[model samples]
Target: MKIKTCLIQDSPVFFDKDKTLDKVEQLTKKYAQQGCELIVFPESFIPGYPRGFSFGATIGSRTDEGRKLYSEFYKNSIDIESDDIKKLEKLSRSEQVYLVIGVTEKQQVNGSLYCSMLYISPSNGLLGVHRKIKPTGTERIVWGEADGESLVTFHTEIGKLGGLICWENLMPLARMAMYKKGVEIYIAPTADSRKEWTATMQHIALEGRCFVLGCNQFFTKSMYPEKYRSLVADQPENMCPGGSVIVSPMGKIIAGPLFGEAGALVAELNLEEIGLSKLDFDVIGHYARNDIFDFNVAKQPEMVKENPTPKR
Candidate 1:
């Protein structure tokens, strides 16, 4: 099956949920009109990525100003059950497209934030969410870690769709879990726009023998609010510099590495390329030496108890 897909490389309405969601609605309608069956957005596309902000943190202290900024950021983030997300679910259904987007998700009870990916299906409403299992570097200051429950893949009529967020794509174990679940279309919604990032996408495409879609935000320092512009004054004008791209299963660059602008990269992915590319190198099949390498992903402690290795 061949499916038309779009990767949206655009900035969010920084720190404003309503405006960002409105943009999402408009973009979805625009692309779906162009016959895109699947549309993916960049990491932190809802209320922006917080690319160069410190949020007032030092080694031993977090200043009051930082706390206020964090508070503002927290206020703008949405919960899984929020009306904002429900609106997105409705958008997917009405547009009749598979939508995958990145957002700063909030836990209502504990006041924790998560860098999360929402997978929406036209017929299924809200399918599921994949939270970033690990937040890279200072990201831990703003985002919380995800347990195994959020590590998941969704099987759709188009293909087996799943992915990691930003730096989570670098986790070998996480990639293995997705591969074991037979992910055919790996969606990488990220903030990293370095030239090397495209190589990582291509490597994953070849390693997993799956189509890869990489998306990032085309953000500028000017996008920051006037009240907060001074905080990012030292930063360059182009903050994120989008590098959205698409790669075939055989490591071929099918679409763009869009940069210095906000736009959508569209492509038609032939799913047959996956199987054809796997003819020689099937990571989970012919190439895997299970007897030589006994690997397991212990999501729960109970599973650990089930297969205990001998202790010295």
Candidate 2:
């Protein structure tokens, strides 16, 4: 299968919920017009990744303004069934492409927040969501840990599609799990724009022998609110200079590595790459010794025992 895939490396409307939705719609149409069969956006692209700021959190402490900021964040989070998701669903249907978008999800259980990836298929509307199983560093203060069930891969006509956010890709067990699921096109949505991150992506492509699509946000100081600007004022001119790229099954740069730019990095993907690469090393197939190694995942992804749902 020769399919065109695009990784969107663009800035969000920085906490302006309405503008972000509009941006999603506009970008979907643009990529569709360009004949992309699937589009991937950076993690937390919806309300923008709350990077370069701690949200006033420290050891067992949170400021009043931090609490207030958290409140606004929850308000902006996508309510699974809300118009925010509906609009994106409708756009996917019209655009006729698969979309894997990162979002901050507000749960009905207690209105707790989670960093998530919403998978929308043109043929199936909203297929499912993959919440980040573990939030990184300060992220734990803001986002809830996900159920193991959210660690999943959804099969589609185009390929076995799935994604991980930022440091999740660095988790060896997590990567192995995706490989075990037979992920052909690995989508990595992250806020890490460091040059070393690119090396990690390349290693994953070689390790899995699957195409790796890395999507990161592109932004500068002006892209944020004036108040927030001071938070990242010390950050270089390119606060989150994008590192969007697509590496083939052979670990070769197929396209992109766009930095300091905002646009879709498009590439043509060949299904044959998977087959050819697997001939050398199929981690889950002829190369595996399942008899020696086994995973301890639940029959179904169960809720985390360590991090219970937050109290309302």
Q: What is the C-alpha RMSD of each candidate to the true structure, in Å?
A: 7.1, 6.4
TM-score against native, each model: 0.95, 0.93
Show model 1 residue runs off by greater than 4 Å: 300-312
- Residue 304 local lDDT, model 2: 19
The stretch of ten residues in a row with the least summed lDDT in candidate 2 is: 300-309
lDDT tens digits, residue span 12-123, model 2: 8988778898999899899899899999989999898888777789998889988888888888888887888788888998998889998888998787999999888876
Candidate lDDT values, in order: 0.89, 0.85
Among all windows of 10 consecutive residues in model 1, the one with the lowest summed lDDT is 300-309
**What's the CA error at residue 240 for candidate 2, in Å?**
0.5
* Candidate 2 segments whose C-alpha is farther than 4 A from its true place: 299-312
lDDT of 1: 0.89
The local lDDT score (0 to 100) that residue 166 gets in candidate 2 is: 90
Candidate 2 pairs with clashing backbones: 149-301
